[model samples]
Structures are given as C-alpha cells and as structure tokens.
Target chain A: MKPITKLTENEKKSALRIFWGQLRKVNRNVPEQDKIKFLKRIPFFELLKKHQLDEVARVVYEREYRDGEYIFEIDQPGAALFIIQSGEISVEIPTPKGEATQLAVISKNAFFGELALLDESPRSASARAIVPTKVLALFRKDLDKLNSTNPDITANIYKSLATIIGNRLKATNELIERKIKAVA
Target chain B: MSGSERSRKTRRIVVYSMTSIFFSILIAGIVYGLQPMILPFIIGAFLAYLFKPLANSFRGPAITKYIRAGALLFFVGSITYWGTTFIKASLPNEREKLQLKVRLQYRLNERYLSLMNLADGGKGNFIYKTLGQEFDELKKRVIDYVKMSDDERKRFLILQKEISDSDHENKKYYEYYLANLKNQKVDIEKLKSLAGSAIVAIEKPAGDDIGNLANIMRALSHWIILPLAFIFILLDKGQIFHFFLRLIPNRYFELAYTVAEKVDDALGKYIRGTMLECLLVGLTLFIGLFISGVELKMAIIIGMVGGLTNAIPFVGTFIACIMGVFYSLIAENVHSFLPFINENNLMIAVLAVVVIAHLLDNAIYQPLVVGSAVNIHPLVVILSVFGGSLMFGFAGMIFAIPTIVIIKVVTETLFAGLKDYRII
Candidate 1:
C-alpha cells in the first residue's frame, strides 16, 4: 500500500507538468510542432515550411461542434477556415435559380469554404455536421502578427495558394463545360 | 523540351491566363456598374450564406431541394417584410416632420422679423420693425411681379392670335405659318440649351445625404440578383472547386486547401455567431426593458435596434444607446396626452435602462454572443472597428473589424515562420 501511494504521487506530478507545458506552449510567440501537425493536415498549409507552418499553428484553434450543428450559413460574414478532424459534414449552397443545392459532403481531414476567408466575400455555402464534428479553425485576426515580421514566408504562402486556387478554377470550368455538353 | 511537356505547358498557360482575365473582368464590372448596389448584393449574399447552413442542417437524402429552397425563401422574405414594414411605417412620419420643419421656418421668418434682425448687425428694437417693414414690401413686390408676368403672357398670345385672324384669309394663313415657324425655332434653341445644361448637371458630383429607403430598395435589388447568381454558384461548387484546384500548379493543392479551409471556418463562425448574437440580444433587451417598466412598444423597438447594432461593434453601442434615449422622449403613454410626462423623469428612466442594457451587453451578451462570434482579442476588435469606420465611413465602420480579423489570420498563417521576430 505504501509503495502504491508513492507511485501515484509521482504519476500525478508528471501529469501536472505535462498540462503546464501544454499551456505554456499555447502562449509562446513561436509556433509549435503540435499546432503545425494540425495545419499540415489542412490543404492551405501544404506548402508551408516548418517555421511557417508553426506560425499558422499558433493562430489555429480547435473546437468541437455537436451533431446537426451549423459550421456556417450562406449569408453570414466569414473570417476563418475550418478543417474537420472527426465526423462528417455537408455543404449546402443556394443557386441563382432560387435553389439550395447540396454542394458536397465533407468528412474528417476535409475542409470547406476557404474562399471567404481570403477575401471579404460572403459565405458561398453553409456547412453542418452530419455527425458530431471536431474542427481545427484559424481566424484572420492573428495573421497580421506574423505578416508584420515575416514578409517572405507570407508572400510564398499566398503565391502557392494563388496557384492552387487557380488550378481549382480551371478544373471547375472543365467540369462545367463537360456537364453542359452532356446536357446538350 | 519533350513534345508532351510543351503541349501541356501551353495548355496550362492558356487556362491560367483565361481564368485570370475572366475573374478580373467579372470583379471589375461588378465594382463599376454595381457600386451603389453592392451593399444589397452583399446583403443578399449574406442571406444566402446564413440560410445555407439551416438548409444543410435540415437536409437528409429525403429532403427535396425545392423544399429547402422554399424554406430559405420564406425565412428571408419574412425578415425582409419586417424590415421593410419598419422602414415604411417610419418613413411617412419622418417625411411629414421634415416638411413641417421647413414650413415652420418660413412662417417664423415672416412673423418674427426680429430673428433676421438679430442675425444681421442691426441696432436695438428698431431693427425688428425695419425688418418687418422690409419683408412686407418684398412680399408685395413678388406677388405683383408674378401677376404682371401672367397678365403679359395672356395679353401677348391673345393679341398675336387676333392680329393673324383679322388679316385677309391668304395673308392670315401666311402670317400664322411664319409665326409658328418662329416659335418652333425658339423652342428648338431652348431645347438645345436645356440639353447643354443637363450635361453639366450630370457632371456634378453626387451629393452626400443619408441613404434612405430608395437606396435600400436599390440595394435589395442587387441582393435579389445574388440569389440567382448563388444558385449557379451552388450548383457548380464541386466543378468550381475542381477547376480552381486544377488551375493551380499540381504541388499547391495542399496549400490552397489549407487557406480555403481556414477562410471558410472564419467566415462561418463570424456570420453565424454575429446573427445569433443579434437575435439573442434583441430579444433579451426587449424583455429586459419591458420588465423594467419601459413601454412595451418602445422597448421592443429599442431592443431590436440595440441587438442589430451590436453586430457592428464599437460605435454600434453608442448609436443604439442614443436611439434608445430618443425613443423614450418620443413615446408617450397612451393614457394621457393632456398631462404631459416630465422630460427629466423620462431621461433618468431611459438612462438607467440604457446603462443596464449596455452592462448586460458588455458582460453577458458580448461574451455569450461576440466572444463566441469570432476569436479575435478585444483590442483587435476595437482597432478593427475604428479602422473600418475611418476607411468606409459608417458601412466601413461595421465591416472593417471583420476585414481586419481576416487579414490577421491570413498574415499569421503566411508568416507563421516569422512569429518569433520583433519587427518593431
């Protein structure tokens, strides 16, 4: 019994230190590897280097949303990106033809509606959980802290994104053309 | 280079240039032709964005697209109805008030000549009498001038016609034709001068004034188009997403996806959070004020305004507070118009309610609504709101904070590498 109590005390101290370390890590100016791990899982951080990824991770936050919850709506102002960690979600977009269309199904490791974050555009779609969802999110407000000090990394990241978004646009057009042709 | 590589490179270049040009032109055209309408378009876009989540939330395989669409339309229509009715009801009263004010000023000038005398550097009580005498003289002269002009025009036309008719038949016809031709020439010259004047009128800068319901209607029309535009956008999101991805270099998919995801998350949280905050705050304020003994109608109106204004951040609180105070003064108990309420008591009561409402907003409403609305710091919120007001005037004041937040996120991610360095 005496030996068991001693073992428990040591374990408790280790747990306390670990918790304190995590808290300290969150407040640090430099980005953390754990944060980058989440960022790297997102498509936007794919091209970021170790340090750049860390900066993103620093601004990123993790949140859990219940089942049937809204990630966002069509007309709300948008200011962040959402990367699903667990559960499934769906995207609904309104058509000019006065229809709300199901755009896509997003699952774990999936992200939707990044365009709104990049510009002042309204949300193009609404996302809601099909199941309980966990998400890692990054808001736009903290981006300046990094930009003021590191211009090159910021430029590169944007340049990379521009290229990727550019490609997506091209592919979308092709698909649209194909659909039109098929319909015709 | 290999033949396959060369063709692929050419294809890539064409796609890149074409999409780039198309997007630029689309954005430019929107800005140029729809500048005034942009707000409404934005509103429409926001409506669509907000409802999209609800639609999705209700969606299962069984829910039809049309049903979802109907629900979205109904909800939006009701909101629009309420907003429009509020404006419609208020507008007539406001317009009448404005007209009365103008009329009162004119009457005052006529009766109280002393006011003008005071304005002018006139000596003693003599100035009042002098001004009264002058005004009377001016009024008489104006009435005479108008009467004289009408009489002259009437006499000239009659005399000209009589002269033409009294002559021999052939001579009369010839004389009449000549007179008609002379009148035509005068008319044409006048029209030409009028056209020249119109061109100058068009060149003058548009005057700044409080944008009224007409402006709102125009804005609404722009948003009406957005639903139509959004339909196409929604239907093609998959294809559009794919196309955007394909346009970028093959290596950049991950980066694009990350940026896209981040943006989506930010906007989604912001929109939903702000709206939720508005509704909750509006209802809470109404209930709170009513319970505290304020008039039910005024309380509801003030609450709604306060809640909506809270969405704007910073100065929104002050505007809402002032509105609340104004309503307290205007709204009298229906029971007694004869024994008018004391202004001092009303002021004190209003001040107390407004203080409580604001306190609740700052402590509970903000944390409950705004804290969860966006993740930016309070300092950032203040900075963004102030900056937005400076750049966009009132609208800018509302939007600037959110825009700053987005910028901050983007900057943080892009320059995540440089976070440790101190630029200042």
Candidate 2:
C-alpha cells in the first residue's frame, strides 16, 4: 500500500509537469501583455466587460493559411469579420478592363467583412492569403444579438465603429492619393 | 376568341382578378376604416410569424417548459419596458432640440431681415452691420428665388396672361415682357427640374425617417408579440394547429400543413436570426465604447436604433449613421457630467469619435453580425431595396431585402426538389 501511494505521488508530479509544459508551449507564441495590446486594437471588443473580454479571448481562434489560399471569395456570403492577426492578405478587385488587380494588401490588425455586417452584400473583392497568415474573426450576427440584449455594450461599440470608419476612410484616401502620385 | 386567345384572356383575367381581390380587400378594410386598430394587429401577426423560432426556443424539456414560458413572457415584458422608457426619456430632449432649432431659425431670420433693410440704402449702418446685412440679403435673395421657383406655375401663367394683355400698351413693356418671360421660362424650367430632383431627394430621406422610427417600434413590438404569442401558442399550439388542420379539406390536409410548416420556418429563421443579429451588434458596440471610456448616451441610443434600423437592407447604413449623429448631439447636450470643452472643439471631437466608431462597425462589426446568414448579393440587395421602396413606400423599403431573401430561399427550396442544387 505504501509503495502504491508513493508511485501515485510520483505519477501526479509527472502529470503536473507535463501540463505546465503544454501550457508553456501554447503560450510561447503570444504573451499575455501582447494579447491585451492586440485585443485593444479590435474596436468592437474594446468595451467588453473584463469577464466578457476574457470569454472572447479564450474562444478567439487563430488560424493560419498558406500563401495563395483563398480566405474568402467575392460574393461568397460568410459570417464573421476577419482581423488580420499576422502576415498579409491581398484584396483583389476586378477592373472594368476584366482583369483582376491587387487593390490592397491588408496587413496585421486590418479587417474585412464590414459591408456584410451593415447589410448582406456579397463581398466586393476576393481576399487571398499572401503569406503564412492568421486571422481573428467576430461573427456580426452573434455580436448584434448580444448588443440588443445588452444596451450598454452596444452603445460603446457604436462609438467605436463611428470613429473607426472615419479614420479608415481618411487613411484609405491617403493611400490611394499616394499610389496615384507615384504612378503619375 | 380563338382557343389560344381565350387562354391568354383567361390568364389576364386571372391575374387581374387576383390583383383586384388583394386591392379590394385592403380598400374595403379602409372604407370601413378598421385600419388603425387592424394595422397594429396585422403587423403583430407578421412579427409573430418572424420570431416564431425564438418563441419555440422557449419551450420543451431543455428548459423547464414553465421557465421557458416565463422567459418568453419576460422577454416581451422587458422589451415593452425598455422601449417605452427610452422613448419617454428621450422625447423631452427631442422636443427641446426641435424648439431650440426653431428658435435658432427665427433668430437667424430676424438678424437677416435687419441686414436686408441695411443693404437697401439704409444709412448710418456700420461696416460690420453692412456685412451682416449683405449676408442676410444673400440668404433672403436665395430664399426668394427658391420660393418663387417653387410656385413657378402660377407665376408663369400670370406672366403669360400679362404679356399677352400688355404687349399692345407700352412698347418697352412688350420688349421687357418678352425678355423677362423668355428668361423666366428658362429659369422656371430649370427650377422645375431642380424641384423635381429635390422632391425625389426629400421623398427618399423622409421615407427613411419614418421607416427608421417604425423599424424601432416594429422590432420592439416583435420582442413583445413573438414571445407572448409563442408562449400562448405553445400552451395550446396543438389545439390551434389541429383546429386549422380539421378545418382543411382532407384532400389538401397534408399539403396545407406542409405549407404552414414552411411558412413558419421562413418566418422563424428570418425574424429570430435578424433579432439575434441586432442584439449582438448592440452588445458588442456597448462593450467597445465602455472599454474605450467614451461617455455619450448617444452611443446607447444609437446602438438601439442601429440594431432596429439594421432590418432595412442597403439603406440601413445611412439610417444608422444619422441616428448615431443625432444621438451623439443629444448626448453631448444632455450630459453635463463631462467637462466642457470649447463648443466647436467638442463637435470636432464627437465627429472624430463617431467617424472612428462607424469605421469599426462597417469594417469589423457588421460582418461579424449578419454576414453568414444574409446570403443575398450586395448589388442585388441594393437594387431590390431601391425597387421595393419605389413600389411600396416605407414598409416595402424596410422589408425589401428580407422578402427577397425569403423568396430566394423558397425558390431554391422548391427547385431543390428537382435537382438538389443550392439556391443561395
């Protein structure tokens, strides 16, 4: 009985060590502080209660795709807004000339699927993973439903969205202007 | 008529008969003037159709059937509570704002009249006064042109009569009338076109305005009726369904039941899914703003309105944005808790904040909410909504996309029986 008890203690120690090691491995790619900073940039989640934010963070998935993998196709309806978590994704738009041009390369922290959220518009452009890429997506339908039930959180999100749109328009115009000038 | 001609005539007669039946039913209802009370009930029934799933969810062993029923009741009660409270609370501020806006117009008008007087050879007017006067005169002149052009028909008719009658009197009068009439006619035509465009523009915004408010009320009403009706229906759903089933001719019993089931599913998915989507959006928005430390009541108000407004496809964005701005303005005015900044600076700050929030919503927020469920192509959705609004006024505009979605779903479902192809 004494020998069995000792063996059990040893086994427990080994199991604890293994668990710790696995946790370390999982967390090695992203530190807690960095995760907070990353989440800060996502405007929608900024106002989530500490507990709710934690719930989001826990479920937040990080997915990687190989270069040239289709992230989403134009006109393919999908749920979830993808935030470029790492690497780059190229946005391709078909010109009136009937050729696809790289309209933009969305980098880390950039997002897509907004037009879908406001209304169900088929995607205007196709997104291709330009490199090994990762994305964090939030489902609009789920989020909006939550908002109706919880007015306080909804209000915060509205403020965040208003500001984000204005800033993006400004930045996009600036980028386009620069591109035009360079070509000229 | 020939057999072919008779068939064509029969088809035309059938089509006209159906249309007239539909029109007459509505006209008859209106003739008796039962619309006001009936309208709300009809809307409520449609809503009950939409949120059938949510009502269904509040049933069965997964949740204690009693608890589920209570939950549904609670849902209805809460919606009523929040809706009335929000509207009641907001109405005063809204009225005050309107009053203030009117007063501001009146003040501007008074200043403008004085300035006009100064412009017309009124001496002893200072340089500042003259500048003010000039600005006022400019506005008056523009307004006069606008008002005059709006009534161009009467003006032109009178001018035409005068031109014909007076052409023989003074030669100068004839010459002047001819020139004035020619110029005025051209101006009048241009103004008419402008007015036509303006009418179109005004009609659009006005429809949206009514639709937006109606959407809020409608959404809130659904939250009430869906749960309430569902609970009662579930409690006696068997009886209700059986009674209808028994009423049906035995030959078409199964077909009728199946059609009812399909309608239930369509209404259920569309309404519940939409409601869920709106709620989620509102919550996410609220959480984001609170964490960001923005303290505007407008955010909450807008979020609520946005969730409600979001039911209208293509046009929802504009409605949501306008509501956001309006709420923000009210929030800024009513909340004195925040320290006062310069008024212009405060406006700029609010504007900046609003712009950023809208971007996040459009870019990141909206897609996450309704993207997966709404399969209609954006271009198609836009066109359908525009067409619907053109045809049926506000209600049509609001229901356009959803109706299209359901139609597409039904068409696909019906076709799927033929070949199992995905319609969406």
Candidate 3:
C-alpha cells in the first residue's frame, strides 16, 4: 500500500481505477441507467442532471402498494415527495358534503406530495393507489442530508420541486377562475 | 379456507418456527465461538452506521462512490490514530497522578487513626493497640534484616520482596502500617491474616494470560479489521439491504421493508443525535475543567467518563456531577492550585461548572441536537433505565430507551396492519 502523498500520477490513476472498479462491482445491483430512466419520468426531477439523478436514486426508497390502499391520508404530516413508477393513484380532497371529490387520476411517470419536500406541512389532499403501484419516495430528511454533503445536487432538486409546485398552483388558479366565470 | 390451504398454513408455521429456533441457536453458537472477532465487526457496523449519512452526502456528481468511501475511511482512520496516540501518550502520567492521590489518602487515614488514639487516652485505643504491636515487630524485623551480613540480608530480602510484589495496593497499606507503628498491645497473627486477605483480594488472577491474549486480539481487530469493515459496509449498504430483501419471500417483502424503515427512523436519529450530544457535552466539560486549572489528563478522563455515561438519560448527569465533585476534592487536597482556593470552594466551583454544563445541554443542545428523536416521556426514560439496569446491567441501561422505541414502533405498525386487514 503506497502512501497517498508519495504516490506518483500513474499510481494514483491506477488506484482510482481499481477503487472505482470495486465500487462498480459492489453497486452492480442498482444500475445507473435504471435510476436515470426513473428520474426522467418525473417532472419534478426534470431539472436534475443524469449524475444528480443518480445521487437522488441513492436516497430514494421504492415502495409497493396494493390496489385500493391509501398512499397517504389527507392532513397527514407530509415528509416526502412520491413519484409513481407504475399504476395509477387517485388524488382526492374531501368535499363540503363529507364526500371525496376526485382532483386527478395520476398515472405512471407523474408525482404527488411535492409540497411535502419543500416544507413541513400536512398533505392538502389524500392519495390512494387505484392499482398495484410501485412508487419512488425521496424523503426530506435524505434531501437535507444531501444538502449538507452535496449542495449543488440538493439545489437542483429544490429548483425542480419549486417549478413543479409553481405549475400546479397556476393550474389550480385557472380552474378556480373558470369555475367563477361559469357561476356568474 | 380449503383443507389443503389449512394444512399448508400449519406446515408453514411449523417450518418457520423450527427455522427461527435453529437459526437463533446457530447464531448464538457462532457468536460464542467467534467472540474475539465479534467486537470488531460490531464496532465496524456502528462506525458504518454513524458515517452513512455523511457518506451518502458525498455520493453526487462531483465524487464517485469509491472516492466518497475512501475519503470517509481516510478521515475516520486518521481520527482514530490520533485519538489512540493521544491516549497512549497520556496514560502513564494519569496513572502516576492517580497513584499519588491514593498514597496521600492512605497517609491522611493513618494520621486520623493516630489522632483518634491520642484523644482516646492511648491505653484503651484498641484499633491502635491491636495493629500497633504487629507493625512494631514487623519494623524491628526489617531493621534487623537491614543490619544482617550479606548472605542473611539477601535471604530476608528475597522472602520480603515476594510478599511486597504481590499487590501494589497492599504494599501501600503495608507502608502505612509500618509508618504508624507505636508502643501499643496488638495481635500479630490477626493483623497478618487481615493484610494477607487484602493482598489476595487485590491480586490479579493468573488466568489473566488468557485475558491478555483476548485483549491483543481485540486490539488487532479494532486497529485493522474495524476500519476495513466500515469502509466496505458503507460502500455496499444498499446492495446488502437489497440482497436481504431478496431473501425474504415476495409476499413479505413490503412488510419487512416497512418495518425496517420504521426501525431505522426510530433508532437511527436517536442514536446519532445522542452520540453527537454526548461528544459535545464531553468536549465542553473537558474545556471547562481545563480552564478551571484541573490536571489536563484527569480532566479529559473525567469528561470522557461523564459524556459516555450521558447515554443513560436522566441519572447520568447526576453521576457525572458526583464524579466531578470527587475528582475536584482530590485535586484541591493534593495540589492546591491557589492559596485562596480551598476544598469547599473547589467543590462549589466544580458543582457550578457541571450544573451550568447540564443547563446548557438541556436548554440549547438537547433541543437542537437530539430533538424529539425518541418521543418517550421523562418518566418512561427513568423507569426504563432502572428496569434495564436490573435486567441486563450497564449495557441494558444504555440501550434500554432505544430498544423500547423500536418495540413501540414495531407494535404500532403491527396494530395498523392488523386493522388494515380487518383482523382485530
């Protein structure tokens, strides 16, 4: 084992090569390509680069939900953003008459609970799996951890999350305006 | 349910129980057989756990996985090396200081005993009377031995050296006994028997050769095996977790994963935060004591012991305070830092410092560093510490809270799952 300070350029390069080779061998389970593909599907991750997406993949937890299972309840303390990998999720809010009104039927590649990642707030609406669903959850804790270690990647993730939330707010305002116009 | 389904379920249950029992025994056997190797692996796992968040942070576009792991390993290894070197350099000095303090304590005790004998009208001073004569005879023998010819002196010295070398503590006591000898009645046999028993009690068992061998093994494991395990475990944690998940049946994978995540959430934050809190507290105490002119090495040792005990929740602070006071008293009596600073004043200062440290920890550090990691009540923490101590001693007390939190999370999850399945 050569001391790092004493190593020549060639030796350093060979050491790095071997180190990377071992790492790649150990991490053969989660392919970078698969992680990239998964991240590419979610609009909230659109601004992240391939490498940044790989960082996100390292912290993202993949969860599977059976059909008719509630992904999260309305008014539950939100702690993560969920991206659907497969199957549909119904995003619904409770109406004044004590009934659930369907807001949207979110499908694969889409995401929900994006607001949770940006702030420590309760979920505004409930999300339930309409089918057997596989979702990738990127927790706020993991993001905060990432922020300390890799600020660049965390900044990109926050930017992407903000954009997605901004778009959703704009769409909601438009829907309200149209509803008012129709009522008048 | 169908008849075939019922039979299959029963068989599955039986097999599962048998498998669990077999594996438990197998694991126990392996642990017992490889006890010497296990400490390193446990320490490595703990190190890997502690560094996981930091390691994860470095896994971004700029740094490759290998570089991140290597950097972490290098950092941890350097710290460990520096710490061990520091301890090695300071240990002998600390030991000498402690021995000096012990000798002073013995001298003080002997003086107090002599004073009591004089106050009691020396004739009825039974303690002095009984032990004094034996010590006088012992002193006379020593004087005679010293005055003897070369061959006689050599024979006497050989016999005396064997007894004296048996235990350092008893040798100190013997010195006190000889020094305090006076013209008073005594029982030589009884005094000799008492001193002999004390020597026997203090003597290290001959079996310590095996113990020393184990210690050497542990040291090798700590220095070499632990860091390597930590690096490798940090590198492939996700892969390892996935491999374990794959081993679970598909039907149970989600449940197991959820349970594992809950356990991590319950234990990980608490453990990490508590460790950081302890380090901060320990470092603060060390600095405070050093500033107060406490002996540097003794200050470090006391601060460290206090900080490590801080893991046991409520009572740990009190224990640390007691230790602080005890050491401060000893320091004041032995080597007065200043003429104005008497024993009482030093005690008050020590207590005040410890109290202030505790206040700062509770008000500022605990909220920020530890922060609702474990939601157990204060009362529960106290009870659990006692209960754990009673059941499993010191280690239990340290781990009891986290263990309870894990259990709570598991039970709540199980109840929620049961309700979801409409089985309750």
Candidate 4:
C-alpha cells in the first residue's frame, strides 16, 4: 500500500478514454439544448430566462485553439468576448521593463475580453491557450443584435459586466495602494 | 526525436495534402457537372443572406424564429404571386411577342450600326448627312452602305475614298469596301447574324405540347430547389457555419473563424444594401412609368432593365434614360398625366422621370439603403463588369461586384489573420 509506481501507458490510455467519454456525453446532448444550459451558467447570462438564454445562444460562435495559441494580443482591437468551454487560458501583460507578467490563469466557465462588447477599445492584456482549448465567442455586433431583440437579456449581461468592471477597479486600487505602502 | 517519429510526421503531411487535393478535385468536378442546376443554390443563398436581417427583426417571446421566416416567405410569396398575375394579364401573346422580339432586336442592331458608322465617319458631316433625306431616314440610312445596290454602293465607296482624310489612307477598312465590297461585307453581316441568333430567347415561349406537363414541372422543380435551399439556410440556425468551423483544425480554428466572420460581415452589408437600393429604384421607375401612361409592356421591360443596370452607378443612369426615351419614342399609345403631353412630349416626360428617379435615388434611396458600403472605384466597377460579362454573360455581370467583394474580404481577412497567428 505504501509503494509508489509511475503511471503505465495502459492506465494513461484509460484515463484519456474516460476524459473523452465525459466530453462525448457533453457533446451527445442536442447542441442547442447544451448551449442553452452552458450559456445559462455564465454569470453574465445567469439572470436571463431560459428562452432568453436560447436567444443568446443563437449568435454564439465556437472556436478551438491549439496549445500556446494566442487568443488575442495586447493592443489588438477586441471584437468578441471569449468564454472557455473546456481548457485553460493565460492572461498576460508586458511590464515597463519589457518582461511579460501573468495576470491570471482563466479556466473553464470563465470569460475574458468582456470589455470588448461594451466598447471598441483595444485589449490591455494578451490571452493565450495553456492547452488545446475550445471557447465560445460572443461577438460585439451579435450582442448588439441581441440587444435589439431581447433588451432584458442584454441588460442583465451589461449589468453583470458593470459589476465585474467595478470589482476589478476596486481590486486594482487596493493593489496600487498596497504597492505604495510597501515602497514607503 | 526518433527517425520513426519524423518519418510518421512527414507521412501525415503528405496524406493531408493528398486528401485535400483529392477533395478539391472531386468538388470541382461535381460543380462542373451540376452547372445547370447551380443557379438556384446561388440565388437562394444570396436571397437568404440578403433577407436575413428582415427575418431577424421579427423575433419575439411568442414567436419562434421559424415562424418569423415563414411570415417573411408568405409576405414575399404573396407579392410575387400578385406581380406575376398582373404581368401575365398584360403581357402580349406568344406569336405577338415573337414578332415584337425580332423587330426589337433588328431595331437595336440598326441603331448600334448607326452609332458605329458615326464613330467611323470621323467628322465627315457631308458624307453622313447626304445618306438621308428625313430625320428618320438619317437613322435608317446610317447603315445604308450595307443596303445599297452593288453598283450604287461601289460608287458611294469611291466617292468616300476621294473625300477621305489622310488618317483613312493608312486604314484598310475603306480599301476592303472598295476592293471586295459585296463578298467581304463582314462587320454588318456579322452583326445581322448575331441579331438572328441572339434575338430575345422567345424561340419556345410555349414549348411543344408533348413536353408540357412533366417538362413544366421539371423546369419549376429546379427553381423550387433554390427557394427550398434558401429556406433551409435561413432555418439552419447557424449550423452551416458551425459545420464548417468544426472541420477546421485546432491550429487554424480561431483564424479561420475570425476570417469567415469578417468576410460575412462586409459582403453581407454590401450585397444587402445594393439589392435593396436597386429594388426601390426599380419600383419607383415602374410606378412612374405606369402613371405616365407608357405602354404596360414597355414600362415593365424598362423597369426591369433599369433595376438590373442600377448596379452600375453613372452608366446605369444614362442607360435608364436612353431606354425610357427610346421606349416612349416608339410606343404607340404614349400619353401623359399632363394635358399638354403627347407621344413626342412623352419622351421628355420619360426623360424627366428617369432623371428625377435617379436624383431621388442618389439623394434618398442610395443614402438611405446603400450608404458607403456599396462604394467602389468607377474604373474597378467597369473592369469587373466587363470581365464578368466576358466570363459568364448577364448573370455574371449582375453578380460581379458582390462576388468580388466576397473574394476581396475573405482573402484580405485570411491573409491578415494568418500573419497575425504566424500560421503561414
């Protein structure tokens, strides 16, 4: 019981099979229904009714990225918000000394580039896949189209966006103050 | 890395490239085989994309999306049905139409030859004016060199050679006319031959009775496939795009998706805006002509021609003007809304209608519907239209701009995206 062993090829294959099995189960559901449920879980869309979630799902685009592929680059004009469907993403920014800093590691069920939907601003940080990643992209124009059709869902998403931005602002302020204190 | 691993990767690359090549060849072969039946799908896809916003505008809690599509189909179907019935009731019978088609083709051929002769006449006003006695004779006799008796034509040619300019001394056209005038009368002869074969395709407006029922259904079936394709695309719920996206390898997935989105956005706006503007302009002309008491038949034809040509900016306006004045000049029952207007005055009225319609189009319709999306260099427009006409006839000419727009957007986006992704 106390002996340790390296994982064998057979065991690795079985683990991969199980992972794929779970993914297949996720995929086996009618795509529309699955997307509706998935969209409903997002904090931005959490307040949306089932039908409203269904409407939002219509314009959602699915994109997959290879490991190390950059989802977006710093200073690039952002056109869409990308929600991680399966794998991890890393958010990085350049420092004053020209070194990169990892701001956060975003995993499944999290979203990045949300600020793009609000305005045509360039991105502040770069995002790259940490692994083979599948993401659902909701484009800004699509969101505006949804706004015309379902103002309630668009309003809820925007409210969530506002809250998220507000929280980030407060955290950033605290971080700056702490840095100043440490310097003093 | 092991040699085996490197070998295996090389093999994979070869396999992928070979498979891609094979599939491309197969698809091309299939499309070539389906040439006759491809129009419907093309038309369907275009209409589907053009009408998508209208369908999108109708979504509500109570209404499912398909219901909205259905409502749009119903609306369009009803209008088409009414239009066809009106047209059928007013259209001339088969024999009358055939005669009219031949006459129109001949008249057009004569007019074209006249224009060509004027251009070639090269400031020889005396040579041009003596060929006719009346204004009508002026047009008819412009090509009179073609109709002259052999002896008279020979004399006419000799006289022309005597009076010809120094520029003509080097030219072989008059020399040919003088040397072997009758047998080598090629250009006008070729024009007549063309007028024979290219006469409006009314050869079998009412096909043989034996081919009626099943043949009619078969003809309708292909067109029906287009609308069905259109409907399925609208109701596809974005599955067509998803299907394509799914096929893209993970490495190129994001790049491909973004490029496709860009192409779709730009092309869709340009096409939809242009189409809506053309439809409105055509409708205005149709209404204007109808109220002005132009013959129903001529009015309908001119309306359609105006709509078709409206894709070309400056050229389209002048063409529409020429068509309106020409039709009014020839139409027997031409009257006008104004009491003082007669058949001759109707030409001016028609010209007024065309100018006003285009003015309104530029001021209101174009700005309101087309906007800046439809902008292209005039030279580019002319070249593309000519290229399209050379390649695929009338349909290609009509579709050239949209097709170019699609290719331009797709290639530009894909190249830019690939560079950004370091894929190529």
Q: Pick by lDDT: which candidate is best? A: 4
Worst 10 residues of 4 chain B by lDDT: B191-200
CA lDDT of A4 in candidate 3? 50
lDDT score at residue B331, model 2, on the 0-100 scale: 33
Name every residue pair that clashes in candidate 4.
Answer: none
- Return the lDDT, model 3, position B340: 53
Model 2 misplaced stretches (Cα beyond 4 Å): A1-184, B1-67, B93-98, B102-230, B234-270, B283-297, B323-342, B352-357, B363-366, B378-399, B419-424
| Winning model by TM-score | 4
Candidate whose DockQ is highest: 4
Which candidate order results from sorting by lDDT in descending order?
A: 4, 3, 1, 2
Rank candidates, DockQ, best first: 4, 3, 1, 2
Q: Enumerate the candidates' DockQ scores in order.
A: 0.02, 0.01, 0.17, 0.20
Model 3 chain B: lowest-lDDT 10 consecutive positions: B148-157
Model 1, runs deviating above 4 Å: A1-184, B1-38, B60-62, B92-223, B230-239, B329-331, B334-344, B377-398, B417-424
Which residue window of length 10 is worst by lDDT in model 1 chain A? A140-149
Tens-place lDDT per residue, model 3, A20-111, is: 66865565455555866778777677778665677678777677887777777677656678889899999999889998899899998988
Q: For residues B235-334, could you state the per-residue lDDT of candidate 2 as single tens digits?
A: 4434465455555432233234434545555655556666666675555544443333335455576557656655554344455456544333323223
Over A110-143, each residue of candidate 4 has an lDDT whose tens digit, in order, gives 9999988987677889999999998998878778
TM-score of 4: 0.72
Per-residue alpha-carbon lDDT of model 1 for B119-140, expressed as tens digits? 3555437654667677657754
Model 3 Cα lDDT, one tens digit per residue, B264-290? 776888888888888887887787666
Model 2: fnat (fraction of native contacts): 0.00
